[model samples]
Target: MGTTGVRTDRLGLLLAQFDQARETAQVRLTGLSDAEYLWEPVDGCWSIRPREEAVTPRAYGPGAWVIDKGAPEIPASEYAEVARQAAGGMSVAKIAEDWSVSVERVEEVLAHTGEPEPDVVPVTTIAWRLGHLHSGFAGQWEWSFGERRREPRLMVDFAPSADLALERFWAELDRWRESLGAVTEEQLDTVGFSQYPYGSDPDDPFISVLFGANLELIHHMAEIAVLRDLWRARFQLPAH
Candidate 1:
C-alpha cells in the first residue's frame, strides 16, 4: 500500500523467517551431547577445539576453546601428492577414489594450489556451526547497533563445552532479535543503517542485510540438523 506499510511487511517477514529458523535449530539441538556436538563425520573437518589442539593457522576467541579458521596446515607430503595429481591430470573423482576420500576433499586440496588461504568449504562440526552463528550475530549487533569499534573475532568468548555453547548461542540470538525489534520503518529503507564493516551492510539497505542474515541462519541451522541426523544414523549404516 504505502512505503511505511511495505517496510513494515518486509520487517515482519524477515523476523518471522528468523524466528522459525531459530526454533527449528533449537528443536534439533535438544539433548545434544558433547560427543555429538564435537563429532567430525570425516577427517579434516573444521571445528572448535581446545586451544592446545588447534591446527589451523588462526583460531578465534580468547577462551580455552577456539573456533578453527584461516589456512589449515596441509602436510608437505600431501602437497607433493597434489602436485603429482595435477601433473598426471587425474580427475577429482578418480583422485578421491584412489585416496578413499570424498571428492570434496580432493577439491579442497586442489584449491590450495596457488594460495595458502582457505578457499574451499570444509565439513564442519556442530560446535563450529554454532560458533559461527554466535559470532555473526554478536558482530553484526556491535557494528550495526552498538559502538561499532570492537571486532567480534577478538571479543567473543568461545564456549568450552556443549552446554555452555548452547547457552551463549541463545543469548546472542536474543541480542540480535532485540536489535532487530528496535528498528523503525524508516531505518529499514535507509542505506548504511547497518554499519557492519565486514559485509556489504554499509552499502545496502538495512532490510537487505536482515534478509541475508535470515538466509544465513536458515542454511547453517539446516546443516546442523542434517549433522544431527547423520550422527543418529551412523551406527546403522553398513561399513564402507
Candidate 2:
C-alpha cells in the first residue's frame, strides 16, 4: 500500500480505541452524581471542583498552572502510573477476528476482572486519575502539535465535576475525531502538532495523540471498575 493507506489504517485503529474507551468509562459513570463523583481516597489527592478556586493548576514555569492552592511539582511521569499500563495487545484491527462472534460482540462489565488488585494504600478517587490524564494528555498534545507549551509544565481541566469531566473531555475528543474523518491527507500533512518533548514530529507521528487518548480512557475505566467492585464489597449492590 501507499503512505496514505498506511496512515489511514493507523488512524482507523486509534479512533476505534478512542471510542471503545469512551464507552467503557461512560458505563462506569452511570447512576453516579456530582457529590458521589467527587469522593476521593484522601485529603491531599486531586479532584475537579465545581469552583475554579477549589483546585489550582500548580505553579512551576511559564504556562504551568497551579495544581492545588500551593501543591508541589507533579511530573508527567507521575501521570503515567495513574494512566493505565497497556492492556497488552496490538490495536484491535490488527488482531485476528472470530468470524462467528462478529465485530459487534461486547463484554458485560463486572465489579472485578480477576486482575491483581491495587494495594489498599490511599491517594485519590478513580476520577482523579482521569483528570490527571486530561492535563497531561492535553499539555503533551499542545506542546507537540499546537504550540510550544510553556513550563514549569501545565495541565488542562477536563471538567469541574467527575460526572461531567469525562463527558466534557469527550467533546474535545469528538472534535479531534471529526478532524481525522474530515481532513484530507493534504491538510493533515501540512497541519501538524508540536507534541515536542514527547517525540520528534513526522517521525513521531500524530497517531501518538490518538494513542494517548486510548491510554487515558482505559486507565480511568479500570479505576472505576475497581471502585465499583469496592463499592459492591462494601454495600453489596446487585449487579444491574
Top model by TM-score, which number? 1
Candidate 2 stretches greater than 4 Å from native: 1-8, 42-44, 49-122, 140-160, 182-192, 196-203, 236-240
- lDDT, candidate 1, equals 0.81
TM-score of 1: 0.75
- Backbone clash count for every predicted candidate, in the order shown: 0, 19
TM-score, cand. 2: 0.53
lDDT of 1 by residue, 107-160 (tens): 777776554543356799999998998888888888889998897787678875
Q: Which stretches of candidate 1 lie over 4 Å from their true place?
A: 1-8, 72-120
